[model samples]
Target: MKVKVKVVLKDGILDPQGKAVLHAINDLKFKGVGDVRIGKYIELTFDSLDQSLVENETKEICQKLLANPVIENFDYEIEELT
Candidate 1:
């Protein structure tokens, strides 16, 4: 199975990196760009074919290592690889 995970800062959390990018966007004269939030995208290949197992493992991986449970949120999708 192939898993794709996304880790992002929770709402109400301050993101300085995102703010810097937003500032740069404004400097470049791009109008109407209100917010820019940065996040992490991870791709993992699992040996298990069972979707449920993969899902559980992915969530555990995100919570234990990939994301800061207090300040960040994570979500993942599992796909069967041919």
Candidate 2:
């Protein structure tokens, strides 16, 4: 089983890194670009096929170590590849 986790800032949160990238993009002559936000992607692989257990464990991982729930939001997907 493979799990993919995405952690990103909430809609109302200001992202300085994203802003810097946006500025660079403008400086590079890209037009019509509005706001930019940055996020993280984490991939996990396991030998179990139990989706419920995986989801629970993944949520625990997020709450404990993966993301700061106060300012960031996270979601995950599980896939079984045999």
Candidate 3:
């Protein structure tokens, strides 16, 4: 089984990195670029094929370490590999 996690800052949170990127984009003469946001993408492979177990563990992993409940949010997708 494989799990892919994406962690991103919550709405209304200030993203300094994103802002910097946006400013650079504007300076580069890129028009119509309104905003920019950055996030994390993680991939995990599990030996077990149990969907329930994978879901539970992935949820716990994201909640505990992958995402900050205060200013960040996370979501994941599970894929079974044969």
Candidate 4:
């Protein structure tokens, strides 16, 4: 099984890195950009094909280690590789 986790800043939180990237993009003449936010992407491969267990473990990992509960929120998806 393949798993993907995305961690992003909560709404109303400032994102300096995303802002900096946006400013740089604008400086290079990119247009129609409104806003940007930065976050983390995590990929995991599990040998088992049990989607429910994988999902539960992934959620636990996100809450315990992958994402900061205070400032960030996380979501995950699971896919069968083969």
Off by over 4 Å in 3: none
Candidates' lDDT values, in order? 0.93, 0.93, 0.95, 0.93
Which prediction has the highest lDDT against the true structure?
3
Which lDDT tens digits does candidate 2 get at residues 1-82? 8999999998999999999999999999999899899999999897778888888899999989999989999999898897
* Model 1: per-residue Cα lDDT over 1-82, one tens digit each: 8999999999989999999999999999999999989999999999889888888888889989999999999998887898
Q: Can you give the TM-score per candidate against the true fold? A: 0.92, 0.90, 0.92, 0.94
Which prediction has the highest TM-score against the true structure? 4
CA lDDT for candidate 4 = 0.93
Cα lDDT tens digits for candidate 3, 17-79: 999999999999999999999999999899999999999999999999999999999999998
Show the colliding residue pairs in model 1. Answer: none
Evaluation by TM-score, superior candidate among 2 and 4: 4
Task: Please give the range of 10 consecutive residues that has the lowest summed lDDT in model 1.
Answer: 48-57
Give candidate 2's TM-score.
Answer: 0.90
* Winner on TM-score (2 vs 3): 3
Could you tell me the lDDT of residue 60 within candidate 4? 96
